[model samples]
Every structure is written in C-alpha cells, then in structure tokens.
Target: MISIPICSKGCPTGMLSQFLLSRILENYPQVITNKNVFTLLQNEEFYFNCYQIASILKPVKELTNILEARNANLADCFIGLIKLGAKINQIQPGNQWKSIIIFNYNRRLGEFINNINILAYWLHPLYRGFGLKQIALNKIYETASILWHDLGNSEESCLNLLMEMRYWKRKVVPYDLSFNSIQETPMKWWLSINVQENETDQLQELALLLFSIVPSQAVCERNFSMLKWFLGERRTNLTLLKIESMAKIRSYYISNTDKEIHFRNKNLSEDELRKSIDKSVVTYDIFENEILERNENLEQENLNRSEENTEDENISSTILNINQFVNLTLPEFLSTGNNLFESITNRSNINERNERGNMEYNPISLAQRILNEENN
Candidate 1:
C-alpha cells in the first residue's frame, strides 16, 4: 500500500486515497488481493460516504482555522461555534456521523464556553445576540452586570448599562442607523458610535475591552518563540531591559512595515534610541504589578475550576464515556491518526508485528475489546 501524506487543511485525504486506490486497482489488479480493501474502496456507496463526510466537516475545518487566527476574539469564537452548530443541525437527520460530531461539539462547547464569551457575543454589533436563546441572553445580562460592578461602577450605573443593552439589542435611536456601515469591523463600529447621551458609555467601554482580548494565546506563544531566538547561547548574557527593547522594536517594525529592519542603520538617531530604551524601562515598572495581579487572578480561577471538577467527577466520567464511544464509532482515518486503516490493511498477520513484546495495535480490534469490557 502506498502511503499518502495527510494535508494540514482537512481530511481531503480520504477522497484522495480513495481515488489513488481505485487507480491502482484498475491499473495493477494483482497489487491488491484483499477482499476487505475491495469492499472498502470499490463500492460506489463508499465514495458517496467519503464525499458526504468531507462536505460535512468542511465548515468545521474553516471555523477551526478562523478561531486559531492571531486576531480572533471571544466574539468571533462564540459566533463561529453557534453558526457551526446551526450548520450541523442542517445535516441529514439520521446521519450517525452528524450525531457524533454534534455530541462532541456540544460537549466541547459546554466545557470551554463561559460568561465572558456570551457577553462578548452579545456585545458584538454584527451579531447583537442574534440566534441566542433567552437563557443565553439572561446569562449575558448577568455577566455584564457582574463585570460592571467589578469595575467599581455604582448600582445605578449598572442598571443604566442593562437598559442601554436593551436599547442596543432593539436597535433603538442612537444605536440604530450608525454613521458607519454595518460591514465595518465590530470594534471600529463601536468606536464610531457617537451618541450625545452618556447612557451607553459603560457598555461601549466594556465592549471595547472585550473585543480587544484575543481569543487565543497565539501571539504570546509566538513572542516566547521569538524570545528563545534572541536568548540563544551566544546571547545568554543579554539583560532583560535590552531584550525587552529589542522585542518591542522588532514588534513595532513588523507591525508598521513588511521590510526587515537593519540594526546598524546609519539614519537612526541617538535621541530615538535613548527614548526607546527609556520607554521600555518605564513600561516594565508600570506593568509589573498589573502582571502579578493578573497571574494571581488566573491561579484563583484555575483553583476554582479544579474544585468544581472534583465535585462533578461522576458527570465528568459520564462525559468521558460518551467521548470514548464517539471516538470508537467515528471513522478513525478522519482523525489525526490517518494511518490506522493503512497499518491494518498492510499487515497480513497481527502476530507478525511486535513492539516491545506487545501485540500489534489495531484500533478496530481494540475498540471491539473495549466495548466488550464495558459491557461486562
């Protein structure tokens, strides 16, 4: 069997492999003698199933890519999940694959989504709580109220914020017919809203803050990677202040221009260099305490989540079982381990292959054994 390299985009590999196998079977009939291979690849229904599966998963793959983007926000993630759910719901009713996908999607949604995500979705001008359930709307209001109070706003201000939210949702005057087009970015539109009244002030502030938050830590991870390059073995003695200045300069240059910045540029002024160094020094002092406080809050949140998980061990176990069941039933080739079927098909005898005195790993057999064990 020829090995096919999996594409990073999606499981187009199934269709590609199917086509390859068909061509091979047609050209070199003697190459494949296994009845299982013929049945799996030669049947017209097999082709249709592969096509259906790919079509169904296309939107999910797109959503995953969107959410992984550097500029993606909580609102983008929340809206994407809701749209993906709706897309899944539109699939043929009796599809086993659809049911499994939906089950896993909902499980992940429950685990990952929080009040902040809901609030971000609600605050997005494009979505404006569209397609959200009444319960979700209530949760959004609750989260907004809590955030308002946390920011040290008075109770009266909190009430005003909620009222403004209602007005915004209904597209009332000031919130209605914005000067900017709806096609503009949500944050830009929020900034452009020039209502003379101060009723929506708190809501605007909160929306901007929420929209400013990146949905993922991709930027931080990239910065860490860049830091590793800067702190290589030859540069181990570099001071933190110098490293900070270098990182900020690199970031600014990257943001402003596609061209690379030369460190030895003769046009650079001494005053500009001194100013940059001084800015990093001042920023380090200014943000150090805020960073510490943010870390403490993150630790507390993790501790609370740990406590909640411990209290709901039974529920967690049940979810685990459901996950296991879904993984067993779904086509394993579509997963990260695309070589499962290839390994099984290429091996004539499982006993012939041994790793560290253990039998060869066959997911099909393993799944059956697990099912039997669970039944017992």
Candidate 2:
C-alpha cells in the first residue's frame, strides 16, 4: 500500500501543521500514538526552525502578492525584488537557513533583473533615476533610442529624445516643477507636460508608452481563464462574435461594479443589447495590430539580449551598483514618509495643474536654495 504524506515540506501548509502539531502534543498527547511523530512534535528545536523558515519566507510571499496585483507594474517588480534582497540580507548571520535562502534568492533575482525592469525603475517618479549607475542609465537610454527607431521615428527624433531625457534628469525649466500631485501617476505626469517643442513632445509620448506597459502576463492569463469559464461544455455552440460580446460586457460590468454578473433568461431587446456590445467591442484590426506590435517587441528584445551578452561585465557591474545604491538610499527614502504602497494606494493627491502653475514651481532653484541653507 502506498503511503500518503501528512504534509508537504517547505510550504505554508507545513508551517501551519508544525504549529498545530506542537499544540496537539501539548493538549492531547494520546491523539498521536506514533512515537516518531510524537518525538518530532515535542521537539522545541523543530518548532523554532519552522518559525525561522516562516519568517524568512514572509517577505517573499508579500512580494509575490504585490506583483500579482492588477496595478503592479515593472517598476513595482524591480523595487520589490531589490527590497526582498535587502530584507533577506538582514537575516541574522547565525541563522542556519540564511545562506540557503540567500543563494536561492540571488539565483532567482539574476533571472528577473533585466534592462526593461531597470528602465521602468529609472522612469518611475518616486526614484527618478536616483539609484542607477551612469552605465545602467546609458543602457536604458540606448534601449529607448532603439525602441524609438523601431517605432519608425527619424534619427533626429531619437537624438531629440536623448536630449529631452537629459533635461528631465537635470530638472530643467518645465521639467523642474513640483510634481507632487502626479508623483504616483508617471504616465499622467508625462501627459501633463505642456511643452511646445517637438523634442519634449516625443519624450512625453515615449514615457507614456513605457509606463503603460504591464509588467507580467497575469492579466492575459486571467482573461483566458475567464473565457474558459464562459465557454464551458454546454456553451460550446456559441459563435465567436457572441462569445466576444459576452466577454466584453462581463469585463466592463465587473470592472465598473466590482460584483458578480448573473446572466438570467429574459426577453431582452436585440437593439439595446447590440448597442451595449458595440460600445465595448474592439475592432478585429486593433487586436491584430496589438498582436503584431507585441511580436515585434519580443523579436527586438531577443536581438537586444544577444547584443547585451557581449558586454556582460558592464551589465554585471551596473546591477551591482544599482543594488548597493538601493541598499543605501531606500531606508532614507522611506524615512522621508514616502513608501511603495503610497503610490499604489493613494489617488486623492492627484490634481489638475495648469501650465502656468506647473512652470512656477522650479525644483532646481528649490534644490539650490536648500544647498545654500545647508552651506550656511
């Protein structure tokens, strides 16, 4: 006869079982008659080890939850990984599991950290290129320029984009405004820039494109899962058009209402139903274009990776510098009352700003004044 394991190892279930087993041994020793199980449950060291493992895994669990969220983006993923690494590094040196956890973490982190994530981290207004090395920053710029060219922009426009990025980094003129209102909304902040120059206009468009990208395929996977539910065995006869209409309506209703949609057999007017579907439906051409664009981006990314492999040393150095900078600055940044969740959760601070008002708040001048005060 095959034996079924009581609990799997290295999981939350195992941790819970360990805790409960300890309690069970204390309360009802007669329940667990097996001497081996009894001996294991009674061991205080086992419980301690379980607690240690749980504590080590907690930050990783939290990071997973954050990344799985709908609003989570590339910037969140980048920062989350950095923070996770930092938290793991803080584990007591004497802890037996510390070395094992660090080894696994570093291996996984190397796989996840790439140029796209680095670019997203640099672009986010909260950090604003704060912790990135010049080499890493240059790589991001090069990536952006390449993407710009691939999008059918002229050489002059690409150069202009590079120039505009410099102004943004240095907080010059229109870019130097107090952007507290839209600090969390990077796309909106980029859109809100009212520069008359064509060069800055390209920057705004590029920023929007970069920030609008979702970090993972979770949303797409979710949609497919929902579609599967909608097209169960009984509903297999439904036409493609009808299925598309139903999916769009269901998505719209759930997004706006945040409630379960119950479909009931009713005598609905065909005209009204058609109008609703038409409002939510996307054109087939648009879907095709999106697919093509994604394929092209994937191809470009593959090409970029092959080229980047030639300069692995520089890339490795850049990553090391980024980690060091994050370790040093993240605590100070958090101490200033700004945090990761604030950007995700807080939306009340977003305000409409006029061009004149935006131009009035010069962050560069403000920084100079602060420096002067400190020198005095």
Candidate 3:
C-alpha cells in the first residue's frame, strides 16, 4: 500500500499519480476488451474524481503511518497530529469538489485531534514550535489550567512545572533535536542534566511523567507479535520464567556463545561445568591442556618461593607430592587432546605403543614418547 508522506515534501506522488491514471485510461479498452468494463473506465469524470481524492487523502495516509509506527513515542504522536491538523486546515476545495464536504471533513478531523490532551503536545520537545503559534498557544495554556488542578500537587509545584517548561522551550531545547534520529528521549535528557544540577527538582519529574506516555499502542502490539514468534505454536505449555528468559534473550542477545548461562549459582567451577555439559560438546583439548599446564606451573613457582622462605624439608616433600599430582592429571589431559593431523599424518607403530591407555604418572617415559613422535 502507498503510505503517506506520499504527498510529503519533495515526494514524486504527483508524477506517479499521473502515470497511474494514464496507464489505466490507455490499457482499459485494449487489455480488458469487455464492453461493460470499458464503458465504466471510459468515464473521464470518474478518473478525474479519483485523482483529486488521491491528492486530498495523501496527507491523511502519511498521518496514519506516523501514528502506527512502532518506535513512535508520545511526543512524536502529538507532533504528527499537530502537523496533520495544520495540513488539513490549509487544504483548499477544488472547483469540482464541494466546499461543504471539505469543511465538514476538516472539522471532524480537527475535533478528533482535539481529544488528544494539549499538554501532550506542550510537553513534547518538537511541538513547542507549534505551541508558540497564536491559536495553539492559547489552547496549550487553556489545557494546562485544567491539568494543573488534576496534578494533585500544591499550587507552587504546578507553577514550577510550567516555569520549567518555559525555560526548556526558550533556552534548552534546540529546533533540530525534534527529528527521529535523536538517540535520547526527552525525559532521559532532562533527567541526566537535572539530576546533575539538582537532584530534588519536582518539576523535572513531572515533565518526565508527561513526556513518557506513548501516543499509540504500536510498541505494545509489536512486543505482542515478538512474543508470538518466540513461543511458536507448539510451545504453548512453556513456563512463564522460561518464556520471559527467552524474550529477554531475544531482545538483548544477537549471537550464541559457548559460555554457559548461570543464575545465582556462584560456586560452580570449571570441572563442574565440563561434567554437566553434553558429551557431544566439541572440546578444544590441546588449548585447554595448555591453559591447565600454565596454571599448574605458576602454582609450583609460588610454592617453591614459599618453600625457600620456610627452609623446611617437610615443605620440599609437599612440593614433590604436588608435582606427582600434576603429572597424574597431565596424562588424562593429553589423552583428551585429539589432533586430526596426528591421526592422519603421524601414524607410527612406535607412538601407538607409547599411547598406552591410562598409564601411571611417568614424566620421563612421556617426554621420551613425545620426542620420538616429533622425530617421525
């Protein structure tokens, strides 16, 4: 469907509309070849009326798209409605079209737009420009009076909110920051600066509340769609915690990693994680073994330093026991270090004898076997 802003500034709708009309007029008689249909298409009045109506409804279509946008905020909705209202007021009746029709349509649209609280527009950063206009400014002040009593605050607080709003409009907010490209929301921007300057500003909090309201259900509807896709048809029985976890993951995570996700289990260790993982999980045994070896060596060096400080024979015997434990674990670690190249390129009978299953801690034999394998 052709969206609005179809007739927005610099749009090619005029040329495209002309092209469409021409194509329909030229192709109807030849392509359709039906007398009844051709007779209907031949009506110049019908085509001209359609063209005029399309031109008139172009801005309305753009307004609808803007309101229905998922990312549109409360401020954006008010700003868009204000622009739409202005565009409607500026529309002139064509010679053929009835003035009553245009007037009534515009009136009805204006009335509907009036239902949106003027404070919404007044609070928005972008619409402050529109609020300064004679007609809109009066309406904004009038709306503020009604909303002031409803704020349930002391008269002093209400007056302060208005004063803060005026300062923001005249001094703080710039014209260009109204665009959709702005990364920070109006409330966030205010809070960042306001908290830095004075943390207890009640007016800043009030303004934040006013600006935080969304103009439409577009964001809610989008989240609902995401929920449906995440759960799928068959997973209707999923737990709420699981569903929420999945939703959060979908929102935050862009890619998968080998790291396991843990919640509140702080004491879990690497060995526990390894044991819990599926046996089919691929292991980079060589890399893991190298890390383990480096860690063990560092521990040994630290222990040796402690032994030097003690000058005790018992300490030296404890170090010898630690070295034996390291050797015992190293064989199992190396056994898991499967190399494709070792299997394919180094198929020697001598090494096959050396790779005896679950051998006792024997560093000398292991070193000799490694040397033989490297020679081959």
- Clashes counted in candidate 1 amount to 0
lDDT of 1 by residue, 272-320 (tens): 6545644554443446667777888899999989867755653322122
- lDDT of candidate 2 over 52-116, digit per residue (tens): 66655665676677677665667777777666665555555656666666555654676778877
**Candidate 3 lDDT (Cα, whole model)?**
0.45
Q: Give per-residue lDDT, candidate 3, residue 245.
A: 88
Best by TM-score: 1
Model 1 CA lDDT for position 94: 45
Best-fitting candidate, scored by lDDT? 2
Give the per-residue Cα lDDT of candidate 2 at 137. 65
lDDT comparison, 2 vs 3, better candidate: 2
Candidate 3, clashing residue pairs? Answer: 4-62, 5-62
The TM-score values for the models, in the order shown, are 0.53, 0.52, 0.42
Tell me the whole-model lDDT of each prediction, alpha carbons only. 0.58, 0.60, 0.45
Predicted structure 1: lDDT: 0.58
| Colliding residue pairs in candidate 2 | none
Candidate 3 per-residue lDDT over residues 1-376, each given as its tens digit? 3232356566546556555645665754356667776676656665566665554465566556655654344455444444433433333344345343344443344344551345555555433434233444544544453454454444444444455555555655322234222454555444444344322444455545555554566667878886766643332587889978876875553232233353424575645643454233334467666777788889999997875664442322211111211222222212211110000111112111112232233332332343344337
